[model samples]
Target chain A: MSQAATTIYVPRDTTTISLGADQVADMIQTSAANEQQRLNVVRNGSRGLYWLEPMLEIDTDRGRVAYGPVMPDDVDDFLATECWREQAGHPLYLGLTEDLPFLKNQQRLTFSKVGLIDPLSVDEYCHLGGFEGLRCALKLSPQETVSQVTDSGLRGRGGAAFPTGKKWQTVLDTRAEQKYIVCNADEGDAGTYADRMMMESDPFALIEGMTIAALAVGASIGYIYLREEYRLSEEVLNAAIRLASEHHFLGDNILDSDKSFSIEVRLGAGAYICGEETALLESLEGKRGMVRAKPPLPAIQGLWQQPTVINNVITLATIPTILAKGPDFYRNFGIGGSRGTMPFQLSGNIKQAGLVELAFGPPLATLLNEFGGGTANGREMKAVQVGGPLGAYLPSTLWHTQLDYEAFATVQAGIGHGGIIVFDDSVDMSEQARFAMEFCAIESCGKCTPCRIGSVRGVEVIDQLGQRDVEFEPDDPERLAQKVLLEDLCETMTLGSLCGLGGMTAFPVLSALKHFSEDFD
Target chain B: MITEMNSTEEHNNGWQASVKRILTELKDKPGALLPVLHAIQTEIGYVPGESVTLIAESLSLSRAEVHGVISFYTFFRSTRGGSHTLQICRSESCQAMGSRELESHAKQSLQIGFDQTTSAGDITLEAVYCLGNCACSPAMRIDHQVYGRVTAEKFDQLVSALRTNVIEVK
Candidate 1:
């Protein structure tokens, strides 16, 4: 590895700021030459404080000593006190990054080395224990590795929350010469960027995780179907892949362990529905992003009729952690069936709107009141939408409910995606309910008749309810007709749609109507 | 309808001027949906409905299709935009942290709708699908500024200081 003194600090993760990193990096390069200091600088991923990004750290006797959110104006001051370990005069310093409460609290199995090392540097990644999981996986039998993951109790973080090891084992059991590993990077759900943050910040982790998936499922090739708008992330991830292939982690004969695995990232033009596992496969095959009939699941016959192991970025990313920490260690973090901490992007009208990693089953109120720091406007919290648009709108009464798969289900809601959108009193419930229908209306892939037509009708029904004018009979038969239509629409959308886009929208819309019907009138 | 690219060699007035001339000539056409949109977007660098009446008369298609197509694609606009068209990808990939809620919040802050320009005429609010940068999901675009893994607070601070000089009818 290169160990020169002058440091370049470009944030590899989307969560990190590069607003001032460029100028600071330039100043560091110039200052080191001016001061006759030996320099080796490379841009690296975020440590994930977010509050203290574009952060520059200096290599010292201990490790990379930290200084952060450094601006162009701080260059001379920073150079004046070069070694941050001794005279770290910068206000951004919170001592070692390991001590930050936001970072320290995280169990960090998936994100273990995310913000620490140079993402593109294969040597740096190895030095910080990057391919250790793959090395360990290569040592074990494929079924044994699958068992290890199964015992680890890791579930998919891509909304469905399915067990990871079982999915791999299913692909392993299925007979196919051209088995594939597909990473669902088509993250369309709102309030979710954990996958993007991990991919951009630690591309190697995803590669390593996918490698593990390939090895466990006895697959050779993998594809990461990402959204089209992430151009910079594509460059960074591809660069990382090149670096990994140059090493023995990605391409043929990885680690020279008699295993040949290769990966590619395909860009989806722009389709929210493609985030679904089967729909993603359809899109990967150069078709429109639409859901497929599921008698034969992706595990059985997927991705051009080959058995496929499909997992979200977070689900695949979690493999390395489950491998290294041991199943028991990873499984000990969460309560009930939810056996690990989930990273949620707390957004919308919340006071503390950023990435939060919390164990499952914490009261929703605690996440909102303590962690989120309550609503953004200080308005009384009206309703909080958990798990993206398809998730339910929980009124304050249900705020005390624990945040877990089962707990949410008991309340007639599901954690479709771990995205919490807070709403203040000013948020019109009827409008939100209307939007839930409208979003479904626009995004439904038109595969199932109920979802395609029902969504459009849902929007119109809500519009009719919201409108003050349209006259009805003295008994208002239209209202009853609309109610019947809504129930039937939700039932059809719930059962008929191929994936969550149509399936989940019913929950939020129904919950809103059931809980906040006053808003509808 | 996908319009093929036209050559600029024969018309030295530049694409923007040609688009204006075309729009002016077609201003009085009734039901000017397909013709105005097709001609203006084809002639100008992009679709700009500066002369609505010219568009209405010349194209002879309904004003509705002209309006809907402009709004639907997310790229077309009725008003002139700032020097930079800062768009944040509000699709599912970027929505993890309340991108939808943040969308409404941002619109409220900018005093603009999905395709409307701000009162200051510095920026326009629009939605885009997956930046393919899901690694840093919850992203947004500010004109050409592509910001990923955006938090509500960061998005607010990003737009708060933006300044640009341009104007047109909404």
Candidate 2:
């Protein structure tokens, strides 16, 4: 038998690609060819460590040693020494890939196989316990499968935090000859990249999870409603779907069973409102992505007036782990109602920004100070916007807030999609507040007046507040009146808007006003 | 006004066949409107006003309905852009990283604001929310290629090279 060729890994994830991983990969290939080196070059997904991206790894007799932030010019020197195999005298060497403090400290459940496998290769995916969930799922009846998910205590990771199993039960209970499972990949949030990372790194997990969902609900067809901006994710997902189909993981009968399920990838035109479930359904049905009034909820009548199950990319991707291991094992990881680990995207002005997958009860301070290693420019971290454009801006005083959904809600904040965007002391909270309104105004679907018009008015009011002089007394009636008016506007938008786009828009504005009032002054 | 209408008419004359072909290929698919519009934009560089009537007829929808979808997405360009398009990020994360300064530099260098094309028709600058590379803040996309940690100097070099047609924008 021939000895297996040594593998050198370089990531093709979009963030890594943006940092010139493609050029670095090309250089390595050229250098290897020039030297006639008989090693295999494999393009893997990111390890969620964005700060150390273009992170290249080499398989050695000991383990996979790491080298990173590698530019094309550095490749010639790297190849000359062949120090990537061991932690030789190379300055870029970081010993074992998994031993890095940023990755070693966290728990990775949903993202276990991410950055560790060749995304396009089903063989590599299966070798690392990929399809075991679907294999176990196929053996159970639909009711039993739903119960397993229900027992796991898994909730929607797409900001709402609704119980995932209950949503599935509704679709399962509804009497329909045809039902649908839609994976919401419209990750339009500004500070979030977990959904995009999972889809790019381990797409088959999403596909497998959706297939398991179809099995649980007795659905025959599924769709992944993806955002338009994610061109790389679309390419990777389509390739993974095609491969899954050939392997009988998707389409027709499953692994010699009588069940039949098929999935398609549908791209959403740019619209933030579509991240709202009902509006997402509207867009998926080939109409304007306007928010639909609930009660004839999507599970009752959705996608051609049939039952449907819609879940976020993270929620669906985490299912494989829940099924592979038992529900108790998954449930044991978190605190309170929140179960399992979430992939937190630590971004913005931070020294070590990346995806940190941990259990639900970690204080925000730990993630910001420890894993994140404080502000990127060595300035003080003044505020952080958790969730997305619509989430609250938490000040340093509130940094001790735990990450559980209920805990975040107690402080009138939300752990929306687990994205925390840090800001340095140089940031102007007044400008950030104005941008919250502006973003809503730009992305609103125009179906609800409060969202469509109130956002525009909100922008005007914020600009007026900004124009007030700093010399004004704390109790100045004219300034106080404007503040009262702004509060009134926020109240109207929060209570009156049809969906979260406008309703939750007030969270950031009010949070900024409450926590960072000096910026407004 | 007469000259403007005549030139628009001439432009429509050039795109009619390709628009028809795209609509014909994608009309049968379910929820075909978005995909059809995307194909037209890809093939013709923009969704021309003249093609709206043809698309509406082919897809059995009203002209307003077709136009509504076209105008809804910031991605679908109604008028023709420059030979190359540069979309700069203005979202919160990027803002925290001096994107406001980058935006100003781009506008000053290109002599155009967001969504405006240069007089020479060589470059168009537009504002986008996020490119999903928040860790490497101050990101921008020229055509479909995303570049990150863009300083004023890097922006100048890229834009100048693109203007001179020294590097392929796509």
DockQ for each model: 0.09, 0.65
- Complex DockQ, candidate 2: 0.65
Docking quality level of the chain pair in candidate 2: medium
Which runs of model 2 end up more than 4 angstroms from their true locations? A1-4, A468-471, B1-14, B166-170
| Candidate 1 Cα lDDT to native | 0.72
CA lDDT of each candidate?
Answer: 0.72, 0.89
- Locate the minimum summed-lDDT window of 10 residues in model 1 chain A: A1-10
Best by TM-score: 2
For candidate 1, lDDT tens digit of each residue in B1-170?
11212333243345545655766765554223434454654345356553443343345545564454355433345555654555665543344345676777777777778766667656767767544333345567764346655677877777655641232322
Error of 1 at A222 (Å): 1.0
lDDT of 1 by residue, A413-480 (tens): 97665777777776667778887888887777787877888788889888877786765554577787
* lDDT per residue as tens, model 2, A1-521: 26566688999988898888999889888877887776688999999888888888999877788997777677777787875556567888888887899899989999999999889999999999999999999998999889999999999999898999999999999998899999999998998999998999999999999999999999989989998888899999999999998999988888888888888888887788889999888888777888988778788898878999999999999999999998999999999998899889988899999999999999999999999999999999999999989899999989999999989999989999988999999999989999999999999999999999999998998888898545677787887888888899999999999889999999999999999999988
